[model samples]
Each structure stands twice: as structure tokens, then as C-alpha cells.
Target: SDTLTDQQKKCVAPNVYSLAQAYLNSEQAWPRAIYLGETPIGFIMLDIDPEDIDKKENAYYLWRFMIARDYQGKGYGKKALDLIIDKCKEDQKSVLYTSCDMEEEMPYRFYMNYGFTDTGVFDDDEKVLKLQLI
Candidate 1:
């Protein structure tokens, strides 16, 4: 929450503290904290579907991700994304998926640069990118 600006806090609303507390308590979700050197920068939440686990065909999904506004540029997003890839690969996930707003060109390009391809789109305003680990 410290990373969020006042306006960002409003957008997320009342659930901010509750969600953060709940997320911290959930081991299955496997949330990770991202840091820029020694300063904590953001959080990434990764989840694997329980049903798909038995077949080893799950897609690792990024549930939440945010980097402080001050950390937006200067290559931090790419480094954070690389961390996601490394974490997912370590978990043996067959693929990973994430959605980005069309207006946010950075995230779209970031996913593309990391070898993620557009696999689906929702509401014609966002794109879903997938990276097959296999």
C-alpha cells in the first residue's frame, strides 16, 4: 500500500487492506514482493489452478502486479517481468498468461519482448498474452 499514491488507493478502495492481509495469508497463491535494489517496489501474485495441477497442464496466471509510479520507467518493469518468468519456470508451469490494457503500450511491449503472444482479448479494450514454457 505504501507504493500506491493517494489516487491509486481510491481506485482500489476499501478492499486494499483486507486484500493485502488476505493475500499475505494465502500460501497457495504464492505472491512475491519485487524490489528495486534494496527498496521494496511492488508485488506480483501467481496462482496455479488446482484441477489442472494433477494433469500438469496449468497456466501460471499473474493475478496482481504493480510497480510504484516512481519506478515505472528506467527498466524496472522488464526486470520485474523477468523475475516472474524465472519464478514460473521454477514452478514448472507449462505456460503463463496476463492481460494488459491496450492503452498501456509498455506492458504490451514488455510481454511481447519476453516472448508472450496475444492469445485472447476481452471487451476489445485489453489483450491477453501467453507464453508457453514448453
Candidate 2:
């Protein structure tokens, strides 16, 4: 995955460094690199809510997703998300959750177009959205 510039970090929540730290520190969080053949283009972070682990309904979160600036608008993000959804389905998760800055138009629209609906929940200033898989 490409390193985010300071300006790009402002757009994507919890920048790459933070995501890496979270993956290292939390048992529930996992991070994966997005690649196109052999080239790395982006990164994704997944999180399973520890509180919901034993519950009948588990919430798998798309904690962070970001494409390299040069890689944006090339359909990589959509394809990467589709692959992530497939993985979630294979895991038998009922839904996938994510949050985005309300002010960031691109990401907000991207997630909505991919079937994530607003859940009327807010985590700090971010708007929460969920995609039902079952």
C-alpha cells in the first residue's frame, strides 16, 4: 500500500499509521493490503466487534479503506470493496459496518453506491453505515 501524504491523510480517516498501530494492538482488528496483480494500490482494515463475537448477530466493520491518490477513480476501490464483502460473507457475518466523515463526499458516496445504508448512528463525528449480508 502506498504511504499517504499529509493532505491525503486528512481525507481518509485514521491514516495508514494509525491503522497499522490498531492492527498491532487489537486482537479484533485485521489489516490487509490491496493489490492489482503484484502492485500494491491500497489498504483495508477489518474489525470484528469483540462484544458481538458470541452474539447471534455479529458486526464486522470495514474499519478503514484507502486507495493511492494516483489509483483513485480507476475502479480499484469498488473492486477491492467487492472482494472484502465476499470475504465477509464467507465468514458468515450478518452485516458489515463502517463510518465516514460526513464532509467527505467521495467516500460517503462510494460506500452508499456499494449498498451501505445510513444506520442513524454516529461515532464521534463520523456517520455510521451498514451493509446487510444476510
Candidate 3:
């Protein structure tokens, strides 16, 4: 939480607090801390909602992701994302979904560069994006 600035915090929720709330609310949410060696650097969450199970395409959402301000631009975010994609592939997931505030420059561009395409879907004012894993 202290890794982000006030502006960044506004764009993304505090990781520790959000993770606690997510776990308390649903067993489907999986949260993980991003670590480099022994140092904590960021956080990510993946969710597989019941509604997602009903979809024709099998996918999981990249529910939340944030790299610390100091850690940004160091290639850690990209490497972490690659690991997440690999995990989904191992689980036989064909697609990975995520949504980000359109106004948030970092996440919007980062996801795009990482091959997530806009899906023309929105949730709570955020633009949805999807990556085809297969």
C-alpha cells in the first residue's frame, strides 16, 4: 500500500485491504503478492465468478494487478504478467479477462502492450480487455 502514491492509490485500491475484503467475500477470488526474491513488490488477484462458468468461453479474470510505483518500468510487471499467463495456460484456460479504468494511463497501455484487446465491455466505468491464451 505504501508503494503507491496518492494518485496511484486513487486509480487502484490498496492491495492488502482489497485482498482481505475479496477473500472475506468470496472463495473464488485468488490474491497473490508479487515478490522479487525476498522483497514484496506488488499484488495481483484473479477471480472466477459463477457467472463466468456459464460463459461459452472458459476464462478467468485478472481481477486486480498493480506494480509498486518504484517498481514500475523495471520489467517486473511484464515478467509477472507472463507468469500469470503461464498459470492460466497450465489450467487450460483459453482466455484471460481484465478491466481497467480508461483514464488510468499505466494499466491501459500496459495491458494493451501485453496483448490484451479491448472487448467493448465495461464494468463500473472500466474498459474490459481480453487475451486469447490458446
- The candidate scoring highest on TM-score is 3
Looking at model 3, the pairs that clash are none
lDDT of 1 by residue, 1-134 (tens): 56666654443223355357446657556566678679977766665543333345567766566777688667887788788888778877788877676653656776788798987666345676778887
Cα lDDT of model 2 by residue, 76-130, tens digit: 9999999988888888888888888776476789889989999897887888888
Error of 1 at 130 (Å): 0.3
TM-score per prediction, in order, is 0.70, 0.83, 0.90
Give residue 17's lDDT in candidate 3 (0 to 100). 77
Q: What would the per-residue lDDT of candidate 3 be over residues 1-134, giving only the tens digit for each residue?
A: 57887766766777767778687857778788899999989998888663544466888888888898899999999999999998899989899998888764867899999999998988888888899999
Models, CA RMSD each: 4.2, 2.8, 1.7
Model 2 stretches with alpha carbons more than 4 Å out: 1-8, 13-16, 50-54
Clashing pairs for predicted structure model 1, backbone only: none
Query: What is each predicted model's overall lDDT from 0 to 1?
Result: 0.66, 0.79, 0.84
Which TM-score value belongs to model 1?
A: 0.70
Give, for candidate 1, the lowest lDDT window spanning 10 residues. Answer: 9-18
lDDT at 104 for candidate 2? 41
lDDT of 1: 0.66
